[model samples]
Target: MNFLTDELDYEECDKEINKNDINYFRNIWLAYDDFWHKNKYDKSKYKYVKTAPRSPNTKYGKINDFYRRCYLILETNEYYYPLDNYIKIKKRKRTLTNLEHIIIKNSGNGKRQSDVQDIVKNAKFSKTYMTNVMKNAVIGVEKIKEKKILLPNEKLFVNMDDCFISSLFNNKKQKNRIRTISANKGTDLEKSTKSRNVLKDKKITYMKTKNGERIKRQELIDKIYDFLDLQFIYNKSSLVFIGDGAPWIKTSAKKENIPYVIDRHHAFKALKKGFIFNRKVDNKKLTNAYNLFINGKYYLLLDFLKVNNIDEKIYKYFKNNKEGIINQKENWNQGVCAESDVSHLVKSLKGYGAKIYNDKVLNNLLLINSARINKLNLLL
Candidate 1:
């Protein structure tokens, strides 16, 4: 309490100290002291007072003596009659692996199954765990039908994506969060959170590694379309989704029947590229950037600038290309939430590089955005 209100609380305490008419300080001081030191204690802190640990026993006690006697008998190769009659524990107890962890995590199954292993592995666990993990990831599709996470009428305007993590086994394998592989990482979801939105409680829909490049664009669109049907919303004094102008993003809006705006990243890139091209540069690259933007080859926009050269200030580069920026105004406005959404995705799954054995696990990781949204919105 002193730390929070500083010494001021102490002064307040002293003001009421001594006389019973004035009020005793013990209750006031103890409560305040406890409040400030809540975290310094454990449990929920400040709400419930944790009992101080019970004093250790000075006597050996009955249970302790019983255990010692049993140990002595076992050491002497003498099995007690009652001890022998105690049922033995089973052999080969199944421990869940990383893949199993994901399957269970993703297993809501519209409440048909509470057992994770049931829907995930059909109740079998083995090396085939990796293969079935893929089957479970596909269960994410079923998950969308009745989102256990997203509240009714909640909209997911974001896209989820991840690169097929490249493998270390001669760089042949690709890892997803639920599916681990060879890639190290740049995947921390919060690391992906830019400094600007730091204080905001913004975990709207976004993709983590789902944007990476491993999952196909068509697959994303199909999932969105199918999920949107499950989420069929009739009105919007209640919900809205935001995302950038990725092609798949626009297509998802059409499929979901939910209103959305394409986020500004694509347009922003075009603006940056335009300035780079206008400024003096080698001829071949200049033509390529212009052609790429004009052709809606948006992904190429950033790479084009990088591969050619970018000596100008990023702001100036955008300013010089202001005309290019204007061209994307509608898209920029529509996709404004792209920054918030996708960046969050990157933050949550950033450090995890575990191999995903299947689609079920992959989709489980992708659902974090929805899970977070539901968690926050629980207040409403």
Candidate 2:
């Protein structure tokens, strides 16, 4: 009974002559006005449109398009690695990537194809194509495979760390993906006390897999190199790399032939472990000895009498032995550059109490650093 299979030869949907039909339409609309207002909104859709029995064709279309969109996300994101071309979608040149769009639309309120057809009764494209676009407009992993991952220049003062995440971990509340994090360090005394999600648009040098279980170490390096190649296409001196003196970073330094700075924070970490952590040294002696060495007054350290000085006195240390002077002079000034670096950068950031990298943590770092570097001209 609901079937209007044949094309309409009737007059237009006008109110003047077909007053009865118009009244009937009004009654139907009034019955469900609030329903459409609450759901995925389409202001133009009239309530006169009744929910008819589901059609096999409509169901088939929904199922097919859903699968197609899923395919688009899978195929496009993967296949379209290093996307060198601009995307024109629905008359807009957009950065809304294929996968991003798919994820965005499906995640929000939108019209279903079946209900839409009842209101419009006509369409710009075939029902199939429209359904396909709406259902699976998201780009796929395949497209991503074809896309070239972009790499921005090695911006200076860029914070760097690596992380692992997976849902398989036992932390039910946390393991939306289980993850571990580490900074670039020569001797990684401890993993980073930071979050995995904190670097999304920050650092401008890396990305995480949506799967959350995957990691990116060397991949970040490769992507950065590729990005550098592109920048070299424009200007040769756009960026620089900054991280602690880890072996991997040092290797990347050689490979990319980029300048490297041992992050001042990590430099202080070495001092904390070596000089600061030593139990044999007392604070007074250590401080005075260091000051003496800094002033190039290694011998005056005994006048400041301390544990090492006491040890020297027990052996008639001042009279019989004097290797301490030579030892302090050789090392104290030699590594001052590294220690001075720590005093500057580490103290500047107050690089302590690092936290786990969650969305909030990552966003803060990314946003703050971005504003500082690109706008304030604060961080290079």
Candidate 3:
């Protein structure tokens, strides 16, 4: 198992030795290396040899380095041959230490397996090894317990959002959406949303196809609730769900009877998109309308829109999300930043779509990345 040697003492040598002489000796040693012979002997040598039952000595009786071969140690070129009889000849099981596994996991920060392998060149980390580590880490995460419980009558603010990433299966491109939930305790929505403190807990789940059939929306909802339950705040604490005005999100909120707040960013973006190219409304009017919305003047905003002859679609967009908009204006100063959160949580899945051909591994990667972002221990 030795992978190093002491420096040679040229001054004390009886005969002059140079690099060429060392190479010659190395070649000779390599040719007779017992470890290599025991592991790499030609099996064909015994193809024609017949042996009796319970024979004491067979033609090819040497034990093979099965563990090394199975674990990919044999594939590495950096192994150094130990001096003859320097150590006892015993079978050593090749295995990765916890630290080494952590290294492999860290090396996979948003990079493809090939790139990760290149980063950990000494280990020769294979796709199989990385996948197994991630799989195990995800399994370990399931055993984690939520120690923090919400106080009675406490209020919890939760943000839910979905981000899409491209998936390739059998060379056909598909789309997968990852849903994330971030929850924290706060009494004042505006102050809590504006604070820089990290959320107390965060989790991610994704919709992926199984057996060539996509998962049902109910299954996705169940997964989200499971995550919420794990946080120990499913129904105990007053929960407020905040997100962009997506139908699926609104439906989920309504199903749970949780109050939903439309994110200010999305509302403002809709307004800008509605009037960005309209020549009828000038910049002053647009600014005025935004101010009115931000100032909780919903009726005034509607009046301004109607008086300015803005598009009916723009008028309807505000009118429909009026309650959510007013809630944001009155309570949440910064509003929800689920879009930014999604970008951070799923950055690894983007731009590396082609490498992630398997849906299972992609989901596992999301779990691992989310755990890392939440500062959870990934070592298992």
Candidate 4:
């Protein structure tokens, strides 16, 4: 057996030892002396006194603790999340939550749980224990459900998009099983883009379900509004939602009485798609649409659509978001988009060829990622 069991009477095997003495005991007891002592280390300050038989329990306890720490240090450095090895084997099944927290904390920083598992798999822990630790880690972000408000003078720039998780979709279900992914940045775009902390009041909402994506989407949007309500009520600061001209986003903004901006990238994309996909409009008309969009003449563009009978679904999208598109130029100068921010939060878990994430796991990963991006010390 690699570990000390109850076979030996600890009461009879006791000894008094110093720090280095404990290290030597651990090295010999764990059969690690040959490998450990071969490594070049300083030994000038060593006070090695081997006092025999004080208490076997004391000796076993100290050596076991040292053994655990040695194994933990092999996994990571001080910069990484601390490992949890304080639980006894008997109670480990119930007390491994601390280990789960450690894994989740590492995941928050973009490390996949699978990657974390591979790194520590050789340690004295069971695969099921590690799996449960990671599973709970992803679901654990729910504890942060309380609404968090924005600071004064801070505007929340929001965007919504779709992503796929392997666990949620199969070929028969939908080749591209899309889930709702939304992100918001609370700081100034220009200033933030130049710094590491590009997003100030960052929050990400991810919803995945085998079915009922629409219902979950609405719930996610409502959660955003609840957080906004706290800031809007007390600070009187308005929200500047930035999205790709999605109907749900438009509708939610209108209902909440909040102003929004159409992301310039998506606006251009919409125009191009409308012109190409929707019955081919003349090159002249396409040029005219681009001109109007750039000049912020959104109403005139709508009129052009009406007169020319260029009624594509994208056309309706443009009409619904006329204010947002116009606001992108006149009121909010420069291109304000959330594509980069949103991508950063979702790429690892829901990217191409990625493993399908469970609905709860996907949601939890988003929240954890957002907390990291926003520099919020979320509850693990």
Question: Against the unseen true structure, what C-alpha lDDT does each candidate score?
Answer: 0.36, 0.31, 0.54, 0.51
* Candidate order, lDDT descending: 3, 4, 1, 2
Q: In model 3, which runs have C-alpha deviations exceeding 4 angstroms? A: 1-104, 107-142, 152-154, 186-197, 209-221, 233-237, 278-286, 308-314, 330-334, 351-357
The worst-scoring run of ten residues by lDDT in candidate 1 lies at 54-63
What would the C-alpha RMSD of candidate 3 be, to one decimal place?
11.7
User: What TM value does model 1 have?
Assistant: 0.33
Error of 4 at 338 (Å): 3.6
Candidate 4 residues 213-318, lDDT tens each?
Answer: 3544368566776655532333424456666777777777777676777777777776666665445646777788877886778899888777766647777888
Question: TM-score of model 3 relative to the true fold?
Answer: 0.60
Say which prediction, candidate 2 or candidate 4, comes out ahead on TM-score. 4
- Report the poorest 10 consecutive residues by lDDT, candidate 3: 51-60
Model 3, 245-309: lDDT tens digits are 77767777777787777776776776776665535535675687778877778788888878867
List clashing residue pairs in candidate 4.
Answer: 10-56, 14-53, 14-55, 14-56, 165-356, 166-356, 167-356, 186-201
Full candidate order by TM-score, most accurate first: 3, 4, 1, 2
Candidate 1 lDDT tens digits, 64-167: 12110111233344322211122111122122233344444543323212343444343344445433443444223223333323335333233333233222
TM-score of every candidate relative to the true structure: 0.33, 0.30, 0.60, 0.56
- Clash number by candidate, in order: 47, 56, 0, 8
**Alpha-carbon shift of residue 377 in model 3 (angstroms):** 2.9
